[model samples]
Target chain A: MSEERKPGEPANEISRRAFLAALTTSAVTATAAALSPLKDVVDLPTLEEFLRLHYKELTPEDKKAILERIAAQVEKDYGVRPNVTDPPPIPGVEFGYALNIGRCIGCRKCVYACAKENNQSRNPQIQYIRVLQMRKGSIDVESAKTDYEGEVPKDGFYYMPVQCHQCRKAPCVKACPVQATWQEPDGIVVIDYNWCIGCRYCMAACPYGARRFNFEKPEIPKDELNPEMGYLSNRPRPKGVVEKCHFCLHRTRKGKYPACVEVCPTGSRKFGNLLDPDSEIANIIKTKRVYVLKEEVGTLPRFYYYFNL
Target chain B: MTLDRDEGSKRIPLAAAGAAVACLLALAVVFTKDLIGKGPGRDDIPKLSPEYADPSTVRKVRTEMTFDGAPCQACHEGAEPLQGNPHEKGIFHEHIELKHGRNQHCFNCHHRMQPADFSNFDGSPIKLDNIQLLCAKCHGTIYRDWGLGIHGRRSGFWDTAKGPLKTQVCIACHNPHWPIFKPLKAAPPPHINPRTRAKGGKTAGAENHGGLD
Candidate 1:
C-alpha cells in the first residue's frame, strides 16, 4: 500500500500525510472503542439531561423545561406520567413532627402508608420509616431491634419509628458536596434527586440514619405510582441518588395531613407548624416534656418524641 | 541627669500599662468562661397557631353524630333503663363490656333520671357532641391535653384562617365500651439494611412481608 502512493507529489510529503491520516484514523477508532464499553450506562441520560443545571440555579423557564423533560422521561420509563412539581411553601408555616412513644404500638402502618403515599418502590422495598422496637427504660437506638417478627408491643418493648427528622441544622445538607439536599422554608429537608452526585457523604453524615440511596433503579408497579408528586418530594428518583422522608411535602403543602399521620390508628403521630403557638406539636412541646433523639449531637431535629403520661 | 529623669518617669507609666493589660485579659477570660458556661441562649420559641386539633377528625365528627344501630331515645323514651348490668339479662345488651375503670353499674356513665345522655362531673346531661365533658369527669388530665390539642392527632391546615382544623373525638379512636384499642396487624418490617447486602440477603417479597404469625 505504501508503494502504491500517487505520482507527482513529494514522496516524503505523501508518506508524512499517510502517517498523519493513519494516526487520526487510529485515534478515532480508539475513542470509539473506549465509548463502546459505556454504551449501556450512557444510553439512559441524554446530553441535554446530563448537562442540566442544578435545581437552585434553574430559572423559572429552565425549571419548567427541565421538569417537562424529566416528566417525559419518567413517563417513558415507568409507564406513568407523574405531576412532578415544586409547590411554594405556605406562608407563616414551619412544619414540626412529633411521635408519642407512649402510644406507638409497633404497628408499621405508618411505614407502609408512607411508602404507598410517597410512591416508593415495592420490589426492592425502599421504606422511609423504620420502627425501632426498643426495650422499656432504654432509648438507645444502637441496640434497638428492627427485625423483630414477634407480636408487637411485645412484653418489654416499645416501638419508636424513626424517619428524616428534617433537622434545622441538617448535617446531610452540609455534607452534600453538591448543593442537592437543602431545607425548605417549611422546615422540610428536601433533596433535588436529579442534582445528587451519589457521593454517599450525606448518608454518612446523617446521625439518625434517615437517608436511603437508590442502589438500583427504584422498581414500582405501574398502578402504584402516585400521580401527585412534589418536585422536591416524592417524585420518582433515578438510580444513584439519596432519598428520605420530606414530611410529605407533596401532600402537606397542599393543606392535607400526611398519609402516615392519617393512617395511624392510635393517633401517635403528630404534625403541625412549630411556629404556630396552638399547633398540636407546639402544644405537646409546651405541655409535655418533649425530647429529641441524640440531642447532644445538636442537629436540632424537628422531630420530637414524648410520652403522653 | 535629664536622660535618667526621663527613664524614671517612663518606668511608672510602663508598670501602669502592664497592670491595665492584665486587667483587660482577666475580663476577657471571665467573659469567655461565662459565655461558654451559658451555652446556646434560649431560642425564642416560636408561637404556634391557636387551632391544634386534627382537622380531619374534627371535621368528620358532626356535633349531632349518632352511634350506629342504637339511638339514645330508643329505650329512654318510654321504658326506664333497667338497673344493674344491662347485659345481666343477656337479652339485648350482649355486646356491652364494661371495661372502663372501677364502674360496675349501668348508671356510672349514664344518668339515672335521664337515660338519653351521658353524665358530666356536675351531673348534668352531657350531649354526645361534648363527650369530652363526659370523659373529663374521670380523665381530667387527658381532657386537658386534648383541649390543648396535643394528646390526640390533628389534621387539616395549621392556619385555621386558611382552612378548617379537625380534632379526632375521643370515641373516634377509643371504643366507648372497651376503651382500650385492640392491636391490629403491623406493617412489614424492613428486610434490607446497609449491612444486609454484605451477608448476601435480598429484599423481602410478598411471601416474607407479613409477620411470622
Candidate 2:
C-alpha cells in the first residue's frame, strides 16, 4: 500500500501515524479549554461528598462525619455554627396541622415567621405559605388573590393560607428521580438536600404547587441564619435544589409548634399529634367542619382546614 | 356557482344572529347593573371599634394603683363611690370605653363594693387569677376550645410527655372591656419576581401558588 501511493502523496505508513498523533493533540487541547470554567466553581463537591452513600445507607459513623462536614461548611459560609441534628420520628406520632379559616386574619405573620425560622432566601423570597384572599361566598382558589395590600381580613373576603399539606400519598416523593425526598415515620415529608440532583421533577409532580426551586444561591443573611437546624429539614440548602414546608420538622420533631403556628396572632393555627386522641389537632378534626385543600386529588394531607362555626 | 351563492347568503343571517346576541348581552349587562359589583362596601362593613382594653395597659394600671397596697379603696375610702354608668363623660373611669356587646352594667363584671375583684353572676367575688371563669360566663364554647388547646395560643411544646405546654389566658389576647380582638396590621406581601410576571402584572403563582418560584 505504501509503494502504490500517488506521486505527490507521502509514504502511507508514516503519514497515517503523523495524522493520528495530530488529531489526539487537538482533541486533548479542546477538552482542556472546555473545562477551564470549572476552576471558578467554589462549591464543587469535595471527595467525601462525591463518594457519599444514600441517606438510608449511611452508617452511624458516616452520618456523624457528614454532619460535622455540613456544620463546618455552614460555619464557613454563614459565619455561624449551626446545631444540626437528624432527629428520628417519634413513634405513634403522626403530626397534623389545623387552621381555622373563619379566624385567619390574613396578617401574613405566619408567612414571615416561617421564612425567618427556615432560613429561606430573603432577596428572592422563598416563603412556604401563601395566604389567598378569597371571596366569602366561594371556595374558588383560582380567582383568589395573594398580593393584597394594607390591613388584612379584608371585608367580604376571607383568607386561606396554604402550605405543604405533607400528603400521605406525596407525589413529590414519588417523582424524585433519586429518592432524595420521602415521608418520615412521623408523616412529615422531608428532603435529603445533599442527594438532590435539582432536576425539579418533584416540583412538577406536586399538585399543590408547594415545591420551590432555588434558582440562585439562597441569600440568607448570616445573622438571620437559623442556628437550630435539622439535617433533613431547615439546614441551609445549596443552590439548585427543591425545598418545601417540612412542617418545621426541626421544631415539630422536638415537640414544639411550627414557627407559623407560634406566630399566628388570631390563634387560627393548631398543630399536634394526630395519633393522640386527646390532642388539639384530633379534637379539631373530630369536631370542626374539617376539609383539606384539593381533596379531590386524594393527597390525604395531614393539614386540615376547618371552620369553628 | 349556485352553491357558492347559497353559502354567501347564509353568512348574512349568521352575522345578524351574532349582532342580535351582542345587543342582548349589552342590554342584560345594563339591566343587571345593581347585581354587578354588589359586594359589601367599605361603609356597609362594620368598623372595628378603636377602644381596645389592651391586657398590658390594664396590667400596668392595676400595678400602679395597687403599688400603694390599697387599690381602689385608697381613693374611695373617704369619698362616696359614684354610681350609674362608668362610661359617661367626666366620670372617674370615663376613659374605659365599654364596647363589649350588651354587657353594659359596670357592676355586672366588676365588684361594686370591693372594686378590686371581678364579680360572678350572683355578685360573688371571683379572683383575678381565674379570669377564664369570668370570660367563660358568656363565651362557654371558647372556654371549652381554650381548654382543648384549640381556641387560643399555646406555647412551649406540643407533646406533653416531652415538654411543658403553656396556654395563654383569654385576657392575654383579648381585653376584658372590649373583648373583641383588635385588627392587626398585616405583614408585607411576598416579593414578586420580575421574571414570572403573568398578565395584569400579577405574580404568576400569586394565588394558591404556595410561594413556589
Candidate 3:
C-alpha cells in the first residue's frame, strides 16, 4: 500500500508543476491583451460610416457621438431639429396599444401621424393603419373590412381599428434570422431597420399582418418633414425594411403618449402599466370584461378592448 | 412481554400532547373575522361590444360632414371591372366634365350617400359598386396606370410586385366622384371621450363628420 501511494508522487508533482506554469503565462498574456487600449479604431471616416455600425457594438461615447451627428444632420435636412434617442433611466419599457372600437371615426389621422412620426416620405402610398368599416356582428376579417371612401363611415357599421398589436409574446422575434427585431422589456417589439435586409420573414411571421414594406423610396416634400425622430420606432426607415407600430417609444419613454393616441379625438385609445394594479386601464380591465383581439393565438397582445356601456 | 409492556406504560401519549397544546394556546392569541367570498373572472375594462355605444366596430355609419362633390357612390356605373383580364378602358381623354378635375377630395368622390344617392347630369342614378367607371370617363391615363398596376394599387393573390392596390375600383383608394384621395391604409383616430381615453384630433381637410346633407 505504501509503495502504491508513494510511487506516483513524483509523476503527480511533475504534471501539477507543468499545468501551473502554463496557466500563469496564459493568464498574464490574456490580462495584457484585454487591457490594451483600442485608440486608433475610435476615429472613423464619416457620420454615414458611424451610422453603419451595429447598435450593440457601439460604446456609450460612440452611441452619443453617433446620435449627435445624426441629430445635426437632421437639422440640416428638415430645419426642425427634433430630439433624438436619449437613453432612459427606467429600462424594460414594453409598449402596449389599446383601441376603443366605439370611438373610431375612420378619418385616417393615425395613419398620417405615423407617417410624420416615423419620417415616412410623402409618396401617399405607405399604409401604416388599416381602419375597416364593417356591418355589425361581422367577424370575417375580409368581408367586414371596407376601405375609406369620400363618404367615410356609413350608417349601420362600427369602426374597428387595426394596426401592429405589439404582442407580448411576439413570434416575429423568433422568426428573425439576424435578430433585427426584438421585444423590449417594456413590451413593444421593434425592428433594427438598419440591420434588417428586407427579408420579409417578419411579414410572414406576424399573425396580425402588422408589418409594412416600403415598395419605393418615400417621397416627402422637403419642407414637410418631422425632424426629431425615434431611433428604432420612427426614424426615417430605409427602403426594403419592415416597419410596425412601436407605441411611439420616442414619446412613451418620456411618459408622453404616442402621437396616434394623442391625436385621437375620441378617447378610443388607452395606455397604462399592465403591472400596475391601480392604473385606470388596469381598473377598467378589472371592473369590466376586457379582451385582446386574438387571445386564441397566444400572442399576448398588450392592446386590450372593452366596449363602453 | 413484561419488559416491553413496562416501556409502553412509561411512554408519553395523548395526555402529554394535550398538555403541550394547552400551553401553546396562550401564545396563539387567535383572532377571527368574516371570510370574504370570491367569484370568477375580473371586470376591469369599461365595457364590451354589445354594451359599447359606438356601433362603428359592429355596424358602420357614414359621416355626414364632407368636402365638395362628396358622393362617389352616386357614380357607380354598374359594370364589373373588365371581367377576368384585370384591365379596363379609360375615359379622361373623351370627356373633360368626367375628369376628377380640381374638386378631387374624399368628399368629391367616395362620399357616403345617406338614405339616397345623387343623380348625374343626365338624370341617371349613380351606382356605388362601379365608381371606377365614373373615373374612366375622364382619367383614362390614370385608368391605364391602374390597369398595368403602375398608377394605383397592384394587389391580389399572386402578384404583389407593382401596386399596393388589391382592388380595381377607382374609388377603392381614391374618391371617384370628386377625386381627392386618402391612402386606404391610413386610419384616422377616433374622437375619444376625455373622461376615459384620448385619441388624436382632426386629420385631413374640413372635418366633415356629419350625416350626408
Candidate 4:
C-alpha cells in the first residue's frame, strides 16, 4: 500500500515534491509569524471574545456568557471587577436634550463631568462633548471654534456644546455597514464594541462629528474605570472600535440624569422623557422657539436648542 | 565523498528552518507573558459611583446684593440719608454700583422705610427669599418660564416619580445688581481633528450657521 501510485508520474518524484511543498509552507508560516507586530503579548483575544455574537443577535444565554467573560477579562486586566450589563430601555420613555444658549456661560464643567462619568481616555483627550465657541449673532457651526482654550464666553462669542444628538433617524446607524450601531427604542444611539469593524464610515456620515474611534487601546487609569457599565454604553472598549455618547444610558436607565446635565452649574442643559407631555423639554418645545441642529438634513435629532427671549 | 558533500549542503536549509520555528515559538511565549503581567494593570483607580441629581437640594434663584454679613438695619438704621449723588460711591457703601437698567434708585426695589428687604410697586415689603415675586412684577413672562423649567437651569431626575427636579434661582446666573450675564471663560474646545487640521477654518465643509446664510 505504501508503494502504490495512481498517476503516470513516478511516485518517488511525486513524494519528493510533496515534501518540498510542505517544508516551504511551514517555513513561510513561521517567517510570517515572526515578522508580525506582536505588540503587548496579551493583545490576542480569548476564544470567547473571538466568537462573541453581535449585540442584536445575542441570545439571553449568549449575553450572559459574553458578559461574564467580559467582566472576568476586565477584572483580570484592570484589577477592578466591573458589572458590565445592559438595562432594557424603560417603558413609555424617549430621551430628549435641550441646551439653553442664553444661559450657557461657556464653562466646560459639563465636559469634564462627562469625561469622568464615561471614563474617557485622557492621554489623547477623547471628549464626547465639544463646546463650540461661536461668534455672537452667528449660527455657523463650521466656523465655531471648538478648540478655543482662551477665556470663554468671549465678548463676541457664545458657547454651544455638541454631542451625539441621539437622533431618531441617526445617520450613524445607517452608515454602519455591519449593523453594529443602531438607535434604541428610547431614542439613544448605541454601539456594540465587539461587533464594530471600525470602518469609520459612521464617523464620516455624522454631520455633527460625534463618534470617536479608539485609535489605540483606551488607557483608563486603574481606579478611574466606571465599574457600572452598560453592555452597549460605557463598558471598557478595546482598540479599534467607535464610541459616542449613549445619553449615559447606564445612569439614565437607572433614574439618573446624564452626567453632563447634572454638572451644568448654569442649568443650561436639560434632559427629560420626550414622550411625557409635562417634561421640561416638552414644555420648551411647545412654547419656546426651539430648533434642532441641521434640521434641513432631516436627522430629526432629539436634541434641541432654544434662546431665552 | 560526493554523498558526504550533499549531506553537508542540506544542513543549511534545515538549520535555517529550525531557527525560524524557534523564533516563532519564542514570540508566542513572549506574547503570552505580556498578557499575564503587563496588560490591564492591577493598579487601583478611584471608582466613581453613578451620580443622580436630587431636586431637593437645588437652590432657588436669588441675588447676593450685600457681601456685608450685618443685617441691612445695622448699617442703614441710624446712618444719615445718602445725600450726595446716589450714583456716586457712598461713604458707607463703597462697592454698590447700580448697573441694572433704568431702575437704579435704591428705593426702587429696597423698601425706603424697611431698607432691610425688597419691595413691590405698592411699597409692601417683600422678603429677601421672595425676591422672585418682586422680579415677577416687572418680568411676568420670565417668572412663568422659570416655573416651567424653560427659562433657567435645573438638575435632578426629569421624572418626578424617580426623583425631585432641582432648579437655579434667578440670581444664580444673573447678578441682581448687574442683572446681566457677563462674558464667561469658555472651556477648552475640542482638539483639532485630522480633517479640520488639514483645512484652514471650516469644521466640516461649506456649512454656515449664521443667520446671514
Candidate 5:
C-alpha cells in the first residue's frame, strides 16, 4: 500500500488511483443527473409533474395511468393493494346539516375520525372545522374564538363552529392555477389528487377560509380504515395536494345522513333537500325563521338554520 | 435674512403636519381593530335582524340558501350531493359526509376574525369582550333552547327572590356538529292532578297548587 501522510499534512501529489477515484465520483454524479426525471427524458415523470394535474382536467386515460402507478407504489411501499373506488351516489337524497350548538360537548372525536377517513397527510394534523367559545352579550367572535388564552367557555362564554360554506359561487375555483378543483354536474366540487400542484392559491381566494394542503404522506392503520370505500371522501388523500369537503359524495350519493348528523345526540342537525316543499328541511325553513351565514357575498349556500325562539 | 424667514416658515408647517399624522394613525388603529379580529362569516356587525333574523311572524324568510357552486370544496372534505332533494334543488349531507365535514380548523373560516362591537344577530356588541352573540349567530336553535332554561348545569339554590337566571348559549355544554347529548323523555309535564279544576282550562298546574304564585 502507498505510504499515508501525517494526520494534518496536505497531499502534494496524487497517485493514478486517487485521480481515478475522483473521476469516478464526478462521472457517477453526471450520470445520475442525466437520468433524473427533470432531464429531457420526457417519458419519465417528476413528482412535481405528477402533482400538477387537476382532477377535472385529467383525461380518463390519465386518471387510469395515475391510479395504476399509485397502486403499484402502494404495493411496493406497504405490500398491499390500496382499495381504490369511485362509489355510486345515494339516490333521491338531498343533503343538509343542522349543528346543535346546545348539545355539542367538544370532545373532538369527529375530528380524528375524519382525518382517518380522508387519508389526510401525516405531518401536521388538519381538521375541517373548529368550534369556538364566545362570551354572552358580546358579538366578539375573537374573545371566545379558539387559539385564545385561558380556559374554555369562561364564566359567560358559548361555543361557535366555523366551516367551509360550499358557496354557490366559489372563489377558490376562480383562483386555482390548475383545474384541479372543479364543479361536478351534481353541483359538488371535487379535487383531482393527481392534478394538484399544492399552489395554495385557492385557499387564499376562499372568503370562508376553507381548504387544506397536505405536506406529507398519510399514515393510517389498516384496521382503522373505514372498510366501506368512498372514492372522494374516505378514499385516502395523497401528499403535496389540496383537499376539502366533498359532502361525503360517496355515502350521501348512496342515500345516508352524514356521520356527524347521525351521531348528534340532540337532533341538532336538520339535513334535506331544498327543492321539495314536503322535505323536512324545506318545511323547517318555510315555517320557521331561518338564515344563512352570509348573504351579501352572494355565495348562495346550501346550508340554512332555523330559530324557534 | 430671507433664508431665516424661510426656515422658520417651513418648521412651523412641518410640526403641524407631524402632529396631524400622529393623531390620524392613532385613530386608524382604534377604528381598524374592530374589523381585524373577528371570526369568519361574521363581519363588523352582529345584527341578525339587520335584515332577516326576525320579521313579522307571517312574512316568511328564505333559509335554504345554496352555496353549492362556490369555492367551499378547497377545505371541505365532503360536499357531494347525496341524492335528489325532494324538491331536487338541494342535496343532503350523508352520515359519512357529515363525519368528514366536521369543522375543527380556524382557516376553514374566519379568514379574518377581528375585534369589534359591530356584530350581527341579537345585536351582540362586536367586541372581543362580547363573543356569546357570535356563537348565537348560526347556532340560534341552541340559543333559543338556552334562553328557555333547557341548557347549562342548574344551581341547587331555591331562592325565589331572583327572577329568571340567564340561560347559557348552546356552546356552554355541547358542540354544534359532533354532539354527545343522550336522548331522554321530557319530565312528564310536572305531574299534574288531572282534576284540579281550572274551572275553565287555564294552565296545567292551575289545580294542584296550594302554593302562592
Candidate 6:
C-alpha cells in the first residue's frame, strides 16, 4: 500500500489526511453553530448551580444554601420572595387519593384550583387535573370529552378527573435515564427538575399522560405566583423540564388537604394517609367499589375512582 | 516507573489547583449569603385560612325569614298547624318546590310542636344544631359516609392531630326542602396547544383507548 501511494496520486484525487481534516473542520463548525443559540440565554446557572451535587447528596446546610439561591433567583424574576422548602416525606404515611365519580359535578373547579396553587403556567395553560366528562353507564375514557361547555353535571354524563396516580411501580421513574424522578417513601412520585435532561422519555412512558413538559419558560403572572413552593413539587420549574402532580406535597406534608380536594365543591375528591386504617381513603377503599385507572397494568396506583350512588 | 512518578508529580499541582478553585467557590457562596438577603422561610409564608360554611347561616340566607326574625310559631300560634306538604300555591312556603323523592310530609322532618326544631324518627325533638340526626333518619347510608368524612366536603387539615377538619353539614350543600343538588357552571377547560391544533385538534388522552376494559 505504501509503494502504491508513492506513485503520487492524481491532483484531483483526495488524500486520506485532507479528507480527515476536512471532516474534523466540518464537525467543529456544526457543533459551534448548534451551540450558538445558548448565547441568548439570560438565566444561565451560576458556577455554584453547575457544580451543585444531586438532591440526595445535598446536606441540610447545602440544601439551605441552594434554597436561598433559588429563592433569590425567584425574587429577582417575579419580584416576590418565595418560601421554598424541601419537606421530607412523613414516615409510615403512604398517601392515597379517591374520587367519587357519582358525586363529581364536572365543574372543573379542582383543575383550576390545582393550577393556581401549583404555579402552573397561565398561557398555554398547564393543568395537572383533566376532568373527563364521561358518558353515563360507560367507562370509555377515549369517548370522554374534556372541552364540554355550559353548566356541568349534564344529563347522561358523569365527570372523572384524572391526574398523577403516584403508582407504587411508576413507569415514569423507570423511564428516566438520569433517575431524576423517583417515588418518595410516602408513595408520592416526585421529580428533581434541575436534574431532568429534557429527553421526555418519562412523558412517553407514562400511561396516564400525567407528565407535562415545559416547552417554554413558564409564564405565571407576578401577582398569581404561589409564594409557598416545594422543591420537588410546585416550585417554578425551568423551561424544558417535565412536571406533574406531586399530591401537593408542600401542603400534604404539612397535613393540609390538597388544593384540588379543598376546592372541590361536590366533595368528589378525597385524600388521606393510606396507612392509617381509620382514614377516609382507607374506609372508601374497603367499603366502596373502588376502581383504579388502567388496573390491568398492575401499577397499583394510589388514585382510585369509585361510585357511591 | 520514573516516568510514571514524574507524571503523578505533575498531576498533583493540577489537582491542588482544582481543590483551590472549589474552596474559592465555597467561600463565594458563604460570602454571598447576606447578599441573597434571606428569602422567606416556611413559617414566613402566609397561611391559607380555610373557610367553613356554617349550615345554620346558609339556611338562614336561603330561607330569608325562617331563622332571622320570623319563627314558625309566630303564624301558627293558637291556630291549627298545617301539615303534609306545606308548599301550597298561596302558602308562605310556596317558593319551596318540594322535589325530594318519597319524602312528601312536613312533619316527617320538621317538629310538629316546636316548628323550629327537627323531628327524629321516634318523634323526639332534634335541635337545629343536631340537624344530622334529622337527615340520618332517611339518609342512613349517607350519614354513615359523612361521619367517616367521605360523603360531605371537609376542609382544613387531613390529619386531625395537626389541625381541625371542618366537616360541612348536609344542609350547607343541600336544601332541606329540596335536597337534590342543582347543576353548577363548570370552570373553563384547559387551553389547547397550537401544535395539537395543527394535528387536526385532538386533545391529549382523546386518542388513547387501548387496554381499557
Q: What is the TM-score of chain B alone in each candidate?
A: 0.55, 0.57, 0.28, 0.59, 0.26, 0.59
**What lDDT tens digits, residue by residue, belong to model 1 across residues B1-213?**
233322222222234444544555554555544534533322222222112111233123445523356765665562554666554654766567878878876678877666657777677788777787887888899998888877776666555766887777888777676687666555555646322323222222211222222
Residue pairs with colliding backbones in model 2 are none
Candidate 3 lDDT, B1-213, residue by residue in tens: 233422222323344444444434322322111122222322222211212111122212234422245532233333421123212443422322334566633233332333133334454545545555556656776565345332332212111222231333554434333345322223333322112232233222111222111
The true-versus-predicted C-alpha distance at residue A289 of model 2, in Å, is 0.9
How do the residues A273-309 of candidate 2 rate in per-residue lDDT, one tens digit apiece?
Answer: 9999999999998878999988998889998999986
Give the DockQ ranking, best first: 4, 6, 2, 1, 3, 5
lDDT per residue for candidate 1 within A1-309, as digits (tens), equals 213333564423323334444445555554554444365583376888788888778899988887787788779977888788888788889999999999998877778778777877654567888888888998877667676664567878888998999999999999999899988888898998878889989988988878888866777667767878788888888888889999889778877778888777678888888888877888888888789999999999999999976
Q: Poorest 10 consecutive residues of model 6 chain A by lDDT?
A: A1-10
Of candidate 4 chain B, the 10-residue stretch with the lowest lDDT total is B204-213
TM-score-better candidate, 3 vs 4: 4
Candidate 4 overall Cα lDDT vs. reference? 0.73
- The per-residue C-alpha lDDT of model 4 at residue B183 equals 49
- TM-score per candidate, in order? 0.75, 0.78, 0.49, 0.75, 0.47, 0.78
Judged by DockQ cut-offs, is candidate 1 incorrect, acceptable, medium or high? incorrect
Local distance difference test values of all predictions, in order: 0.72, 0.76, 0.53, 0.73, 0.46, 0.77
Provide the clashing-pair count of each candidate structure: 19, 0, 92, 19, 94, 0
Docking class of 4: incorrect
Candidate 4 deviant stretches above 4 angstroms: A1-36, A39-41, A57-68, A81-85, B1-67, B77-90, B193-213
| Greater-lDDT candidate between 3 and 4 | 4
**DockQ of predictions, in order shown:** 0.10, 0.13, 0.03, 0.21, 0.01, 0.16
Give the winner by lDDT. 6
Lowest summed lDDT across 10 adjacent residues in model 5 chain B is found at B47-56
